[model samples]
Target: MSTFRTASRVDGNQSTIVASLRRIGCTVLLTHQLKNCFDILVGYRGRTHLMEIKDPAQPPSKRKLTPGEEEFRRTWQGSPYHVVETIDQAISIVTAP
Candidate 1:
């Protein structure tokens, strides 16, 4: 279990990306509220994926993960973390074998 000391913020494009993933039959849970963690947990093909949804419209610097997020991703031993800037990227990740 991950310990969250603060609430997380959702990127502007997160909902759109999530909707697309659900349309393609993936189960998406909004994990963005977990501080220093990935924004979404995706279930597909009996596997789970962790995605950090970065809004493409944001500037590069703003889209980058925070120090805490970086550390969490680096140390996490469960599913690998993915950073996605577009809905297509998120879809491809969850759909890929």
Candidate 2:
């Protein structure tokens, strides 16, 4: 049998990010429960985006991606993937033309 470690599910920054996206006329879907998947699925202006939300307080060098996320990044050929460290960045990505 293999052991599994549950990923920390609480992200203090997600609420702000979701609010910011919605305020800018984007639809945001929280996918935090989907392990290794992007944290959000966003739609705007007839386009979709996959976003992995990261804590800005965490240094980039210390951030690590799960095996599933790695595979998704390497193999998926759908919407653009983004790593957003702040609400501003998330909003900018979804709103950018």
Candidate 3:
């Protein structure tokens, strides 16, 4: 099995969000894999959420999704997917009623 390590660009903001999600009782799975997929998979209260992580400092115009990511988003018919740039945004989506 290959070892898993955080992506080079995933700095403090991403780390904080992941930590907070776990603290709030959600199961957070980091999915930065070789395949075309979303960044994180969160399960809470029996619901699953697919999230794409983006840098908050990056301008929207510059934030182009990869072709693979675009394909996955287009084809995925599972739970609601989100593009979250901050911890609060992630928390809000994952904990929505």
In model 2, residue pairs whose N, Cα or C atoms come closer than 3 Å (at least 3 residues apart or on different chains), thus clashing, are none
The candidates, ranked best first by lDDT, are 1, 2, 3
- Kindly list the per-residue Cα lDDT of model 2 for residues 20-73, writing each as its tens digit: 899888998988777668888999999999998877777765456667777887
- The lDDT per prediction is 0.88, 0.80, 0.79
TM-score, one value per model: 0.90, 0.83, 0.81
Candidate 3 pairs with clashing backbones:
none
Q: How well is each residue in 21-89 modelled by candidate 3, as lDDT tens digits?
A: 999999999886546677889999999999888876777764566787788899888887788888899
CA lDDT, candidate 2, residue 20: 87
Q: Which candidate ranks first by lDDT, i.e. highest?
A: 1
Q: Choose 1 or 2, whichever is better by TM-score.
A: 1
Clashing pairs in 1: none
Best by TM-score: 1
Poorest 10 consecutive residues by lDDT, candidate 3: 2-11
Which residue runs does candidate 2 get wrong by more than 4 Å?
Answer: 1-8
